[model samples]
Target: MSPSAVKRKLSSSARSVSPPPLRRRTDAVQAQRAAQTESTNHSHKLNFYSWNVNGIGPLLQKQISFTPDATYPLRNFLKAHEWPHFLCLQEVKINRADTATQRRVELAANAGAQSDEPTYSTHFSLPRDKYNATGFSGKVHGTATLTRDDTLETAASVPDFDLEGRVLIHEFATIPLVVINGYWVNGTSNPYRNPDTGETQGTRHDHKLRFHKHMLDLCKSIEERRKSVLLLGDMNVAPTRIDGHPNLRTSPIQHVINRADFNLKFLDKDSETGLKGIDVFRHLHGEKKKYTYHGRGRPWGESCDRVDLIVASRKLVDDEAVVMDTDICDNPHDRGHSDHVPLWVSLDASTWLNQSESKVD
Candidate 1:
């Protein structure tokens, strides 16, 4: 079946499942007591934040060159807010030589005077193997995840999908939840056609489709094992028209090259397990027109899109332990740092990580 047909089917099926009711916040006095008891209880909620840094080297340079009084956007933002327990970054773009230095700087900036060594452990994935064999320098381009809870350990990555440093999987100690961080392939255009065969040349769009298909298969495999999953990153595809400007449906840009491919890859349910993906942001703020990425050289409202996403299993959404609060960070300070804004969500770690009986959809 065509991708659009699959999308329609998924949409219709989704409507059949009623959404979970919202929970009420604790009263002020109750909140105070909860805060007092938070330290003793291991059931506190956790925060998860994800961002596409574009290129880490340039961002670091920008932060370092700032005048004493001038604010380092990311650093200041990290210091100003209460840090999340888990932080995932995409398009980090750093090589081996720069990893240590970059990590130290980031840790120090985020740590502030709180500690010399922050509690969070960091991991990075760089392009390797065939990628380097193609004369591609394994340099500044990758993904990284930092977690305050040491229980989350690195797991095996999807074989071919990790070529461009695009995927990272982490398994939690007690929870059946697996966090998948991805910087999906941005389908770029290649106008060159084969002269002899008169067939269109394969572009990055092909790779994007393949990557997404493999990712779906991987998620299905995880679900078969009865594990709950949370997939977050710069997916490079707006799952619905509500996700970006309506004009993007026809845009000639590389990222939006084959909209059908994206719809087919992400919108369809897993054929084997019947597992479907849910957009955490849209689920919370339906039809809200917010953009996380602004076009280069274009004014704010003139050209922008929401390519970053956080998708979770249906069971995770229903359990109320996976995604709590989600938003696109478009503060003035964060805007100047990168063209893409940060997307974050709050996770009820205690319930999600400890509740093994939680169903996996």
Candidate 2:
């Protein structure tokens, strides 16, 4: 073959095997990575429910010592609403010493079953007898949380605050979240009566100062670890004037203190020195009036305040897959039980479970 013909054939081979332009190669790689992320990511709707049951006894049994009824108010709740992934109960009024009572509460919570294995894992933060000094039993202020058995990586209560059975912290197995369930101290201004002296002592409002400061720290601790937080249960604070009916609080100063603390430190979106906790309700429905707690016998709308809340971390809210819906249940129940009605939030399963699920119970 001639030298010119050989050279031409070599040039053709080189042109055929040439690499793609840099931009094209980069875009191809980016498209492949995007596809992988899209495949792994998903949208989910997970329901979580919370209620201040007042007492666990009435739902399962007429009294703590009696047998649980065949049908219960708790049963009515579960059947009526989407079976929640986590059910947070506040003011359970149970003590650690009463293991039997705790077990009964657990049994009723897990579909009121006495024989079947429990589908939920129950965790309670029981109270100490510190208040016994004031002629009141500390056993009346417990907080509890129940989730599916496999959902937790770790679980605990606040060491100092839980003496009144006020808090439970849960780290989940499937999400980068640390959940806190609390029955926050009620800052009632009525001074405790000393039966011995027939006189009054300082108010329970003192506990409020400490309880809230620690609550802020707890959220910060989770934020420091780069994990999100979802805190729910009866916080006992109305948060703003619109959150309460006028004059519902007997202690305005105490109420003001608490409302300020919760608003400025956590729920304020413009906060520069906070965990930037998102009030799930306010985030979804801005300034729309809603109430969760009602006066015992009055009509709900006539006299009530919205004290129950589900607050989330900014990180969690920023995630596109996690849809937090504001269909909070504040109503006359299918079966009326507690003065404080049930409330809940919806989360997408794809945000954690990486799959889609049925929206219904």
Candidate 3:
């Protein structure tokens, strides 16, 4: 079936099921403030979705089944969530030399061709180093951003950080907003070594720290310009103990341990600038044990963590620009889609965009 037909079928199926209720807050004052804000700004909202698709090439291949009931997770996801104006994807793993990879990119770029859905202007950042002599094919992994046509005025990648195609930045034409789609370096395999001692300097832990520092500096520069920024991706870090699996050891060898440390540094308020970030999902759904990634291909036990996240500038968080319902799409039935599920956020564009304009004036 065509994309449109698949969407129509899914729409019918979705109507039979009701969504789960949101958790209630104990603080009455906070609830009252949120109610007031919701009443005032109910008209303008923009949905954003971020997924580390694991690999676009593989997803496209798996989605080509002939049976009607065969699970085409990626295609079904796109059809079901038509509200997202911006879709950010990571670990696309599309190399320039692969023709199949080129075809998959083209299909994604022209996703709305046969339907009434809004077309997206796709931008990709492939690895700068084409040849992979290091045995680790870091050059094949990449990130992508697909924004509604005419929505973006400027788009580019960070200089040093773009080496492995890990980051893509998009600036909107009318709004003072910058959306950064990133696939942070997974330092698990690349151990940091000291030149003088000829021993392990910091292991994968040190490599991740350096990566976070670069990301922090880049985000700081954008916020310095007074733009309301939304940075979303597989950060590869779970902020606290609450975000990590309880059974996992909090050791240097453990990825969660090192990643959590860097997460704190990234979210820390700068002494001079006083800028900070708010993890939107955790802010809304406090202490909810939602896991976005399942480690070692285990279903969901002690190996899961909420590594995928959407972090926004404090200005946007303080202004109540986020429309509360953030989620981790962890569907066990759709295992073939990816190991890491998608995370999404809804933002009140009218409120934030106006506030940003006033800052300029």
Off by over 4 Å in 2: 1-44, 62-71, 111-118, 132-137, 150-160, 190-203, 246-251, 319-321, 353-361
Q: Any idea how many clashes model 2 has?
A: 6
lDDT of 1 by residue, 1-361 (tens): 2111111101222112112212332476334533443333344466778888876654444344434433334455454446566678887766544546555534433332222222344566665534321223555457776554222333434345466677877755445777888888777664323334546657656766667778878887887887877888988887666666645645565455455565555544553433476778888998888888876686576767788988888778875546778998864456555678888887765564334334422
* Candidate 3 global lDDT: 0.62
Q: How many collisions per candidate?
A: 3, 6, 0
Task: Write the residue-wise lDDT of candidate 2 on 100-214 in tens digits.
Answer: 7766655555544333222344667776535432123445877776664322234444555456677877765445777788888787776643334646566667656566778
Best by lDDT: 2
**Runs in model 1 with CA error above 4 Å?**
1-43, 58-75, 96-99, 102-111, 115-118, 129-140, 149-160, 191-201, 249-258, 268-274, 319-321, 352-361
Compute the lDDT of residue 7 as modeled in candidate 1: 12
1 versus 2: better lDDT goes to: 2
Question: Candidates sorted by TM-score, descending order?
Answer: 2, 3, 1
lDDT per residue as tens, model 3, 1-361:
2111111111212111112212332476434543443343234567789988777755554455566434334444655776366788898876644444544553544433333333344567666543321224543567776554322234444456556677877765456678888888766656555433446666655666776778778878887887777889988877777777765445556675565556565565554532378888878988888877875456466578788889888877786555556787776643346788788998766655455556656
Off by over 4 Å in 3: 1-43, 62-75, 109-112, 130-139, 150-154, 189-203, 253-257, 269-275, 320-324, 352-361
Point out the higher-scoring one by TM-score: 1 or 2. 2
> Least lDDT summed over 10 consecutive residues: which range in candidate 2?
2-11
User: Worst lDDT window (10 residues) for model 3?
Assistant: 1-10
Give Cα distance to truth, residue 353, candidate 3, Å.
4.8
Tell me how far the alpha carbon of residue 166 in candidate 1 is from the true structure, in angstroms, after superposition: 0.8
- Give the lDDT of residue 252 in candidate 1: 63
